[model samples]
Target: MRNEVIFHSEALEKEGNTLVQMGFRCDACGKTSYPVYELCPFCSSGEGSKTPLSNTGTLFSYSVTRVPVGPFKPPIIAGYIDLPEGTRVFGQIRADVKAVKTGMSLKVETGTIWTEKDGTEVIGYYYTPCGKEKGGAE
Candidate 1:
């Protein structure tokens, strides 16, 4: 069976052993939105096209959830990545607790973040170090 994306209808693309997300660029405003948007939220423009988002970005901010929630375990690393396209997207930061910090570099990824009671997989975007040195935990 094919994977189901949690966000847009068509966003995830698999290459080799990795999964990447496709963003939408507004033709009217030049704004880009992750998981794709029907209309550009920045300028409220409806004209847009599919654009591949850079897998690389800077770690803007992050938080570790000590209390477990849903299909995610405790210490769930979540944060915002400031992409070069001027879009700041949020996703799970898959990295060692010690290596993650503000201003760090990150790369976008795609995977199943959770599974519903009916066994439906929640596939979504995630992040990790751009260098892939510290490695990702998700």
Candidate 2:
């Protein structure tokens, strides 16, 4: 899914169909927002630029869904991650539900989250516990 069409192109940066990162920074208030906004939500300023979001962040909160939803498998982990730029992004966490914890370090990456009705893979951002945090050498 290296060059697949991203689910949300505006917020997810891409280079020739390859997803780069997510979010944009407000040129006025310097606040960052996900899902790209035409106007800054914090300052209501129209000046903003698309930028690659930080790959690493601290897990703020999370939940595990044991029941399947839509095309998602059971035991789906999703949560909010606080980035270094102060942007809080919500996305699926790719890890064991029992290992997920608040304040754990997470790294963002693009992957095939699901498929469309026509079978087109939808590439999107997902977070995983950092190697070090997962008891592995980084």
Candidate 3:
């Protein structure tokens, strides 16, 4: 079965089974926004286009939730990742809580985040620890 992503449909591009996150780059200021805003937040310009974001980023911060919420399992790990394009994105990190660290390099991947009421597998972007940059020195 194919996975379905419900939120921020305009900011997501699907190439077969792979999902790529997109950002809106303001034509006036060269600033980008994740989830694709209609207007530039900095320059207040409406002339911007959607562009693909970097697939890799550095972990800025993270938190572990010990309580289970809805379709999420206990000890859910989520963090803010600083992309190379100067955008900070918040996404769920698919890594061990004990192994998670600030400044670690992470690669974005698409996966099933949860199931819907109609039994659809909700897809979303997630981060996973990647090679090197473990000490945040990248």
Q: Pick by TM-score: which candidate is best?
A: 3
Candidate 1 residue-wise lDDT, 6-76, digit = tens: 64347776667666678889998888897687888888888899787888999888999988887788889
Model 2: lDDT equals 0.84
lDDT for 79 in candidate 2 is 93
Writing each residue's lDDT as its tens digit, candidate 3 over 32-55 gives: 888788898888899999998999
Q: For model 2, where is the 10-residue window of minimal lDDT?
A: 1-10
How do all models score by TM-score? 0.77, 0.87, 0.88
Q: Name the regions of candidate 3 deviating beyond 4 angstroms.
A: 1-5, 134-138
Greater-TM-score candidate between 1 and 2: 2
| Model 2 segments more than 4 A misplaced | 1-3, 16-18
User: Each candidate: what lDDT?
Assistant: 0.80, 0.84, 0.85
Put the candidates in lDDT order, highest first: 3, 2, 1
Tens-place lDDT digits, model 2, residues 20-79: 775768887999988688888889898888888888999999999999999999899999
* Pairs clashing within candidate 1: none
Off by over 4 Å in 1: 1-10, 13-18, 115-121, 132-138
